[model samples]
Target: MQRALAASILIGAVCSVLSCYLVLKGWSLMGDAISHAVLPGIVLAAVLGLPFAVGAFAAGLACALLIGYLKENSRVKEDTVMGIVFSGMFGLGLVLFTKVETDQHLLHVLFGDMLGITPRDLIEVAIIAGGTLLIVLAKRRDLLLYCFDPQHARAIGLPLGVIHYGLLVLLALTIVASLKAVGIILVVAMLVAPGAIAYLLTDRFERMLVIAACVAIGASFFGTLISFHIDGATGPCIVLLQAFVFVLAFLFAPRRGVFALKRSNSHSAG
Candidate 1:
């Protein structure tokens, strides 16, 4: 349980931090895409007796690069390209899963066994999450500028290529760390919801970062506790909690919630 809690905290913090950029850049679907696209890599790694992280990272980077290339070369939009790429890779993964002979560990990749995390698992989570968090902090302002206005960033002499693909790589790393904590399906929620809810509640990027971290950590801790009490799946519980919070922020947040928007509209009419 302690190991699970530690892993949860580490991943929660990392996901929340990166999610601020995801929300700002509108790359929520990219997160979803990479999360599912790594399945084939996991399966192949099992077959070859390699670390699943390396395979997952490679698959995710391939997906990211493919989407970028298609979007840049073709008239098709990024979202459309992402949908085709991730779904195709995910289907390939499902086929591979049927052919691969593996232990129950594979099940954890799909649904996550939060309480089943071991000491070694904790160490991996720590290193991945710690490294990702540091990179985000060190390059936050530059990244935020890149997210908001790539043209302006490039005009000011920033490396557009690095910022663009660097974010994809970071996203892959974050998902790799989170796989054991929330699985592929629910990790997308962790990567989107906290930052989104924070976006609704705050106007400043720094404030968004702090609020997102608090929300994710709070949800992870309490969700684990509630899951244990109710014998529910911890990943789903944590995601559901974040979803519930997003709803509240959507409906009732001070400056940007639905009610607030309606009130501002009314004032304009008056």
Candidate 2:
């Protein structure tokens, strides 16, 4: 249980970092889609007795690439394309699940058991999380530029395709890394909530990332402890804790919080 909780903290920290970029770029739904889309990959991996993370990563990256390509070239809007892809992938995963006849495998992927996390899963999560952090840190400037202004990034000789695809890869890694603790259903919440709350509290991208990581890690730790004591599902509990933080941030964060805005308005009126 300690190991599982520690792994959840690590995963939360990593997700918080990447999610800063994801939320800023309006790619929150993309995170959701990838989470569900990876289901078939897990099912196939189970059938072939392969590493679940490998299968999930492969399937997720493929879907992400497909979504990007279609959005760039097709007449369909990006959100529409994402919707279609998410539905198709989820449907396929459901079909595969029905065929597999595994005991609780589908449920496990949907709502994970933190207490059941293995050392192998932890190692996989560590590799992906560490590698992603390294890459993101190395290319922080480019990613920020791309997020703020893709046209300017291209004008500045940035490899737009590379950065775009790299972000997707990072997102996939995050999803795969987090699968064991949070499952596909709640991983999106882990990815988006901390970052969203951080955005409300800070305008600086770097600060937002730091704040999000802290919030996510803290919530994961406390939630795991709470779940352990109460005998509840760890993932959902962590997510609910995050939601509580978001509500608090919304109500009390400096500058953007409702109270702050009200004070500012009163001062202006005076």
Candidate 3:
């Protein structure tokens, strides 16, 4: 249980960091789609008897690149393209699952349990999370610039294509690494909710990242505890805890909270 909780905390912190940028850049649904798209990869890996994460990551990166390519060259809106891609990939996953006749694969991908996590899994998560953090931190300036103004980045000769695709690769790895604890279905909630809540509280990117990581870590720890006590599913419990945090942040956060807005309005009127 201690190991499970520790792993959850680590995963949560990692997801929080990536999610801030994802939410800010309006790529939240992209994360969601990638999460689902990896399902077929996992199934295929199992059939081939290969490492599941590798297969999942490869599939996810493919989907991300496809989406990026389509968005850039086609007149179709990004969301619409993503919707079509998500549905097709997810459908393929379902078909693969039925063909494989592996019940565990489907269950694990959809609703993973804390008890299912192992030391090896935790270590894999750590390595992926650490490497991703280093890359993101090293390229923070470029990423921030690209996120805010891609045209400016292009004008400055920043290789927008490389940076854009790199971010998606990192996102795919993060989702694959997080799958064990939150499962593919609920991982997006973990990725987006904390960041969204933090965004409502701060305009500065650094501060938002800090707050988002804290919220995600806190929710993971508390949710794991609650899941243990109540004998419930850990993934859903964590998601619910995040929702609670978001609610509190939305209602009480200084700059964007309901009370804060009312106070500001009243002071202006006064």
Candidate 4:
């Protein structure tokens, strides 16, 4: 239980930070694509006796780079290319899973085994999550400029390529960091929901980051506690809690919620 809480907090922190950028840049699908695309690497890593994270990072980075390349070179839309690449890689991973006999459980890989986390798993999560947090925070302003106005950023002599690929690399690493605790499938919510909730609640980017982190941490902690008591899946419980928060923010947020908008309309009419 201690280890689960620790892992959840770390996951919550790192994922929430990145989630803000993703929400701002409209890269939600990109997170999903990279998460699913890491499956083949995980399976192959097990077969080859390498750390699953190494293989997962490699595959995820490859997927992100490939998507960028195709988006640049082909006539196909970016979203369409992302859909194709992720689905194809996911399919390949599924095939490899069927062909390779490994000890790792498929359900665990897909949904996560948070309660099953070991001391080593906790350490791994700590290092990756810590490193990712530092890098993202350090580069926050540049990344924000790049996401908000790529053309203006380039005109100001920013290295758009570096910022672009750097963010993708960070995104891939984050998904890799989150692989064990939330697994491939549910990590998408970890990457998206908190920032979305924050977005609805605040207009300032800095405040957005803070609110998102708080939301994620709170949800992760309580979700883990709930799951422990109910004997439920940790990842799903965490995600569901984030969803619930989002729904509340959606209906009650001061400036952005449904009721808030309705009130504004009524006042304008008055």
* True-structure lDDT of candidate 1: 0.93
TM agreement with the true structure for every prediction:
0.97, 0.96, 0.95, 0.98
In lDDT terms, how accurate is model 4? 0.94
Q: Which candidate model has the greater lDDT, 2 or 4? A: 4
Regions of candidate 4 where Cα sits further than 4 Å from its true position: none
Predictions: Cα RMSD each: 1.1, 1.4, 1.5, 0.9
Off by over 4 Å in 3: 103-105
Candidate 4: Cα lDDT at 113: 85
Ranking of candidates on TM-score, top first: 4, 1, 2, 3
Tell me which residue pairs clash in candidate 2.
none
Rank candidates by lDDT, best first: 4, 1, 2, 3
The CA lDDT at 148 in model 4 is: 93
Q: Which pairs of residues collide in candidate 3?
A: none
lDDT of 4 by residue, 181-224 (tens): 88999999999999999999999999999999999999999999
lDDT of 3 by residue, 2-95 (tens): 8789888888888998888888889999999999999989998888888889889989988988888898899999999899898899899989
lDDT of each: 0.93, 0.90, 0.88, 0.94
Candidate no. 2 TM-score? 0.96
Better model by TM-score: candidate 1 vs candidate 2: 1
